[model samples]
Target chain A: MTLKIKKTDYIVITAILVWGLVGFWFNVQGAGAAEHKYATIYVQNEQVAELSLSEADSYEYSFDFGPENEHTALVEVEEGRIRMLPLEDDICPRHICSHTGWIEYTYEKIVCLPNQIMVVFNESSRGTTREDLDGVTY
Target chain B: MQPTTLKMRNRLNYLTYLAVLITFAVVIHTVEAALPLPMPVPGVRLGLANVITILALVLFGLRSGLLIAVVRSILGSLFIGGLFGFGFWLSITAGVTSCLVMGLVLVFQKRGLVSLVSVSVIGAAAHNLTQLGMASLIIANPDLLRGYYPLLLLLSIPTGLFTGITAHYLEDVTRRMIIKSGPGAGQ
Candidate 1:
């Protein structure tokens, strides 16, 4: 039997490919354009902590996270790189944040959905939070 | 044989097909979960089990296809130890939503407006976007939408095409097989 590939099928496929490539182009252009110098931690959409990632900077801090601030999260930064350690009472099943290791680029981020934690890298030292890189095509 | 007996036999035959489809879906789901994806973004997958979904929907009906999709997600998550977890919820929501979208597309497909590949592509995109939206809602992080959704959208195109092509060909093979072996063969 012959496979029936109609005109609409070609149109749909082409539309999806073009849309996808456009989104990809925007993402590529937005990322890695600035020199990331800080790692900002956000929990439940609230900015909790910001740490510098300068070569001479080194720090390890345990910050309270979660809805009630009951869970403790540790972060370590050394030599212009930063990483998030697992929680003391790690309720997160995946621990994807810790598995992500270190992120030094402006485009890289560590997100732990289970614990509602996000570590985002930014270029500016403080203020001017770069609006989380736009292009929200779904 | 009594008429009721023949009816019962037919019902059993139909149930068996659905059962086999569900089993195939579960196996593919679990195996795909275990395989490593080259993409760094989380929640991006090949969605290979969609082939079984398309097969069931095209051959059996929408209800059976939806049944397979939900059951496969539930059982597959159970096997992978992600039951009721964030990923589990993501899988369930995305799976059901995509199944419904494909079922809707199947209506147009019957009218010759689109092909199986088009149906599959639309369903795959629905699944990916739904998962991202659900994840964003669960975490209360709208930043994820602006940060990661675009990249995932870009990646879904190729992966959707891959599963769509596979489902298209498999649908053909299975149709021929059913015609040869099914009870309606003489008719």
Candidate 2:
């Protein structure tokens, strides 16, 4: 028996290809640049603090979700990049956030789902808050 | 032979075929899971078990295909101890969504509007989309759909084609086997 390819098959494949390409283009465009100048911290989807990446600093922040649920994360900014160290006092089962080492790109982020904390980088001059990074971080 | 007896035997044969297909799907799933992923992206897989599901769909019917998909996913998850968790929910949702989409495609194929490869591609894409949607909801992060969704769609093409070819061959071989073995060979 001979396998036959139909016009509809080509159409569907082309559609998927175009969609994926457009998505990839938008993703790349949204990334802006690879330069990192500031590190912003968000707790519970709200921006809590912003740190200058030019200066070396290490700090610990605690997020209290409720009376019994509290999580702490160690944020370290050094050499124009930022990293979240594994928190010894975090309640999350896996320390995946801490293991995601130094992020310097504008679109890069370190997210702690259990704590609802997100540390993301941006260009210092782009005072405009872009929601492009919202759903991109895993 | 009695008509009732022959009908009973046919039903039994189909049930046995379903059992064998389910076992084959579970084994494929387990072995695929054991293989190291080429990428670190979550929810991306070769979906090797889909080969069995598609073959069942083609050889038997929509009901048998759906039965294989549902049973294999649940039992496979149980075997892996992933039942009721994030992975289990994602797999079940994807499996059902793809099964329905593939069934619809099969309907269109009967009219000569689509082909098996197209069905597999659409099914694979549907699986990814369903999983992404479920994952985002479970993680309470709609952001999970941003960059990964497109990548998953693209990856599904190759994987779908591979499974489609495998199913095509398996379907032919199984059909020949069934013919040679006659109606109630196992009995």
Candidate 3:
């Protein structure tokens, strides 16, 4: 078994480890100290809606989605954090978006792949540039 | 043993073995999809079905491994009722890509340059990267790849290690079983 641990194998393993570490470090740093002030919703890569987040403003919003708009996603915001309400229609088979529970940080994003919907948090002072959270590399 | 007769028998044996491996892989894939992980990560899974793929590759060859990967992904998606959906596309693309990667690694393994564990690790990493890349394309969001890639890469190491070890032992057990079955068993 030890014989199988050849020089090339070690290089592959070490490269993977280093790449993963760098990505993780970048993710942590990109998510650093910035406060999220707005939650922007994008459908098919277009900004469909934007909601300013604040401790004093809490509300639930429902929007139509899907090819024929046959499905709806209900979003709940409380104390500046956002979450998706589980729908009976099951627009998404996996329900990963709803199961994501809540997003309080700029790094967290609620994405519904089936519906092509994405909800991302933006920093208070940063422009609506999506690349701010795209710094994590692998 | 007559050469032609032995060749035919070996073909029969491989066909039956392929069927069995596909069945095992399908069951594992469907069950894994049904069982949700505690973490909310979008695309992370143990990829346990890969064990059978590696097993087939080790026992049979690249062709067998690729056949199992494609057949199992399709049948498994059918079982889970996700056929032709986003998840199905993601799985098929990733599965085929990784199987090919493992097949390439098999050459080195034969030369004693790498072990089954390395083959599995490379396959797992390829699977994850391919899945992430496909997801990004389908979702039209590069951030999805950028954001969660590290976590997926990190997780693949352990998951790959577990599946690789399992595949190694499974290959041993399966070979032993074949040897014990009879002299007529395909070598």
Winner by TM-score: 2
User: What DockQ was computed for model 1?
Assistant: 0.26
Q: Which candidate do you rate higher for lDDT, 2 or 3? A: 3
> DockQ: which candidate is best?
2
Residue range A1-138, candidate 2, lDDT tens digits: 556778998898888888888988877776565233777888787887888765344454344443455444567777666787776544656877888888766667899887777888643423233455665544
By TM-score, rank the candidates, best first.
2, 3, 1
User: What is the lDDT ranking, best to worst?
Assistant: 3, 1, 2
DockQ of each: 0.26, 0.39, 0.23
Candidate 2 runs further than 4 Å off:
A33-138, B1-4, B184-187
TM-score of chain B of 1: 0.92
DockQ of 3: 0.23
Q: Is candidate 1 or candidate 3 better by lDDT?
A: 3
Docking class of 3: acceptable
Proportion of native contacts kept per candidate? 0.52, 0.58, 0.48
- lDDT tens digits by residue: candidate 1, B126-145: 88889989988897766566
User: What TM-scores do the predictions have?
Assistant: 0.65, 0.67, 0.65
What is the per-residue lDDT of model 3 for residues B1-187, given as tens digits with 9 covering 90 to 100? 5546767766766677889889999999999988889877767899999999999998889888999999998999899997998889999999999999999998998898878788888899999999999989997777678878887887888888888889988888898886775347545
Clashes of 2: 1
Error of 1 at B86 (Å): 0.9
